[model samples]
Target: LHGKKINNHTANEAINHGFALVTEERRSTGIYAYLVIGFNSLISNIRNYKNKVGLLDNSRMKSDTQWVIDSMRVKTPGHRTQIGSLSGGNQQKVIIGRWLLTQPEILMPGSYTPLRA
Candidate 1:
């Protein structure tokens, strides 16, 4: 990673270098099935949404959630809806969008087959 030798303890260091990996089991490991869509959209990047006072910024979360929904083309009634209710494809989209917010230089997705070449 950027010429630095990465070790098992340096996982965060790898991530800091713009590395992202999406899990193969999206339903079982990628998403919180009972949580709302907005939660799923922001959970991966939640640390960035903290304000100066150590509180979450709701408006910012909402905006970013909307971005995930629109940019990922995830079809859901609203952010408050439980993510488990969505189709499997849509859940994967949310996972991808979650990682995209980190602006990773390298994205490795697991167990994927495109419908078209």
Candidate 2:
């Protein structure tokens, strides 16, 4: 009821759907790669755009996003680096960054973490 063409819970519902555990195939191909991008960038980007408060508050968003990638020990020379070129562990971090930025009430990495520890 927010708008004639709008649904307030639409974005929230979408993000919830995105919170899943997926297993990547042993070999990489364009189709699998597209699935990765869909799960990582699309959901998070939509949530952020819909939730922005101000440019100032956005400071934490940027930092926290980078932090998730760093905490996962991704070899991004810069935070803005494209996630596609990274090794598998690093690529997982990018997806993690997407989820962490949204600060979802529940997060399930679902065995994607390749680290031994």
**CA deviation > 4 Å runs, candidate 2:** 1-11, 14-46, 49-58, 109-113
Candidate 1 stretches with Cα past 4 Å from truth are: 8-11, 115-117
Local distance difference test, candidate 2: 0.51
lDDT per model vs. reference: 0.86, 0.51
lDDT string, candidate 1, 8-113, tens digits: 3575765677887788998888999999989999886788999999999999999999999988888899889899999888888888899898888789999964
Q: Whose lDDT is greatest here?
A: 1
Tell me the deviation in Å of residue 30 in model 2.
12
TM-score of 2: 0.51
Worst 10 residues of 2 by lDDT: 25-34
lDDT of 2 by residue, 1-117 (tens): 223343336755645544433335422521134343333433454444435453333455456555665665656666555546567766665666666566555565555546644
- Candidate 1 TM-score, true structure as reference: 0.89
Q: Residue 70 in candidate 1 has what lDDT? A: 89
RMSD of each: 2.1, 7.7
